[model samples]
Target: MKRSKKVFITLMLMICTLSTFLVGCKKNDSKATTKKDFNYYTAEKLKEAIEKKEDIIILDIQVKEEYDKHHIKGAMPTYAFPVKTDEEKKKIDDVLGKLEGKKPIIIVCPRGGGGAENTYKHLLEKNIEKDRLFILEKGQTGWPYEDLLEK
Candidate 1:
């Protein structure tokens, strides 16, 4: 009886330890994937990049009206939604083809948030390199630059 009890307790401890190890590994894996996938640039940093004439493409995902009303100067207006259809994917591919693949791309949306991340994911699905894509930390709303372009 004593030996059986001891064996049971040992088995329980081993199971608990294995579960803890697996949970820790899962957490690390998620963190590593997120770190590997994409990067972010604040509005100020984006402005500086523009000023420096860095070889980057600013891809805006806002609606046409919003884009026409105000957008970062030199930003390409490509409207994108979080959920993409086949036609939308094709459109994105066409736009990407226009740009040099080696150049870094920054995605933006209204209010400096939301749709940009979704667009980033779509870009990844289109096989854009993780290093070459970035999300604007705070979409156009966060941009401090005064000279937003108008239609």
Candidate 2:
């Protein structure tokens, strides 16, 4: 009876741990807004902004190698893709000054994926108002304006 009780308790503990992990793994949407909730700066809109000389900023979070090969003409190199860790998130601070003012900040990720979203959220947490933050709709990969890219 003692052995059986021990086994049952062990099983219960294991199940509880697994359940906790599963719940933790579930995405916490409260910290980050849905994609639709973000201010999506489409490629066409960016192109028009560039042509019109509007005040805007682009932060490229691609890997250094990819960013070196090509990025938006005036985009700042963050080289902080998948900005997940506390350390990685600090990379955004390096360009915090440039993010000031009413200019819109366009986060340019490889494929308009987590990197961009992460960067956008970090900026918001840093107190930059939502109106000044944007995620490039399709990211640099979907940017169709070849001339606007810098090698």
Candidate 3:
């Protein structure tokens, strides 16, 4: 009976030690694996950012026609559709060239969702650092128009 009790105690100790080691390892692994992604800002915050004259590029991904009607005061238009050819890529590069690579990019779409999301993903795939990307929470739908400009 004493031998059986010793064996059981040894097993329990081993399990406890293994579990604690795994938990500690998991915490470190998570810290290392954590990744930065595109950030979301509310309309008010975007206004504040603009007012502060923060170094940012507001990339409007709405269709050209809609963008022409009205858009955030200093937004540059860039269609959200994927670039298919070298010419299309050059056009995108031209727009991107207007700002320095380190400038934060704020993406806005007509009503958010697909356009903004897809554009965000495309930019990521293009190797634009995630820390430099942001999205307007609700796009033009949430914008107050106080800082809007019409072309």
Candidate 4:
């Protein structure tokens, strides 16, 4: 083939290759593959929700004894502390499993608590959305609301 014809063919091939790549890159550019779901509520917001009687679940992530002693009113005790027994492990799994698909899960522990934070991380690793999970910053010990339970 002549030099000019050869050059023209090579340029056309390069153009076609570039076009294919560009088309491939352009595919599905109009929509995002993932959507953000869930919302993280601040301490004040959580309090407000509780006061207003909104749809939410308060999770007490502390030792069962501490929970029994004192915890946020209407909060379900979900002991996330170190598990020393199969029954405890089962309880944790049962609690987490139930909360996994449930949104508005508010996690709290005693004031100056640590266990709930670890459990929160675990839940995140288990594919829990950050927004779906919220930590009651001050925990039960500092919670302004009064504990409603029969002593």
Badly placed stretches (over 4 Å) of model 4 are: 1-42, 82-90, 147-151
So what's the TM-score on candidate 3? 0.64
Write the candidate numbers in order of decreasing lDDT.
2, 1, 3, 4
lDDT of 1 by residue, 1-151 (tens): 9999999999999999999999899988843445345598888888889989998999987877888778899888786644366665565677877665788898888865457766777788778887888888777877777864545
Tens digits of per-residue lDDT for model 2, 47-150 = 99988988888889998999999998888898999898887788888889888889888889999978888888889889999998898987888999999989
For all candidates in order, the CA lDDT equals: 0.77, 0.88, 0.74, 0.66
* Model 2 residue 84 lDDT score: 89
Clashing pairs in 2: none
Q: Kindly provide the TM-score of model 4 when superposed on the true structure, using C-alpha atoms.
A: 0.59
Runs in model 2 with CA error above 4 Å?
A: 1-32
lDDT at residue 33 of model 3 (Cα atoms): 33
lDDT of 2 at 148: 95
TM-score of 1: 0.69
In order of listing, the candidates' clash counts read 2, 0, 0, 0
Candidate 3: count of backbone clashes, pairs at least 3 residues apart or interchain: 0
> How many times do residue backbones clash in model 2?
0
The candidate that achieves the highest TM-score relative to the unseen native structure: 2
Q: Comparing 1 and 4 by lDDT, which wins?
A: 1
lDDT, candidate 3, at 143: 83
